[model samples]
Target: MKKILPLLLIVLFSCSVHSQLNRTFMGKDIQYIEKNLKMKANKVQNLDNGLSRVIFIKEKDLGSSTIAKGEGTLDPMTTPPVSKKEYYTFILDNEGKVIRTDYQKEYEKK
Candidate 1:
């Protein structure tokens, strides 16, 4: 039973570590989006389809102003609709720079 005890402990420890890793990854993504994208993001959630998702609402205009129009219309006048053509699921490293991006397709019903 001595060997079994150690093995069980290792399994439990690994499971806890993996859960913590996921939380940290999600938090890093939130921070990166807030600082770099200048957007306020809703809480991250894992979808039933197994994708981690976050909704970022654009908050500031970086350089989208026009001389005549003042701040350009790039800012959504209202809450922007989620784009089916453009959406990103970002994979961030420990440093929080996007390591890769997975674009999601619009769901279709048969």
Candidate 2:
């Protein structure tokens, strides 16, 4: 029981840390984004317009399994999962300061 208690405490503490780190807001500084998300970005580029754009692409949300069919809800026991493509772009000025941020969703290709 003592060992189990320590393990649970460790998990809770780690969860707290992870949640804090995952907190994000718009208009954050370019440096902050670069420092935190460079490794995760699909592409980081300095444009000819003397600005930088860092793009992060993810399909992090999966649709629910329950679906409405013929006025009744049906839950598939084993079926394909659905996901949406998401794009996060951070636009930075010449001084490496963020000018704006854009989040876009595109239809997934079949």
Give all candidates' CA lDDT scores: 0.48, 0.66
Give lDDT tens digits, candidate 2, residues 22-91.
Answer: 3553446655775776547787898878988888787755644654355544544533455677677777
Mark the regions of model 2 whose C-alpha exceeds 4 Å error after superposition: 1-28, 34-39, 61-64, 68-80, 107-110
Q: What's each prediction's TM-score?
A: 0.27, 0.51
Estimate the overall C-alpha local distance difference test score of candidate 2.
Answer: 0.66
Q: How displaced is residue 52 in candidate 1, in Å? A: 3.3
> Pairs clashing in candidate 2?
none
Model 1, C-alpha of 47: deviation from truth (Å) = 4.6
Q: Locate the minimum summed-lDDT window of 10 residues in model 2.
A: 17-26
Give the clash count for each candidate: 0, 0
Q: What is the Å distance of residue 99 in model 2 from its true position?
A: 0.4
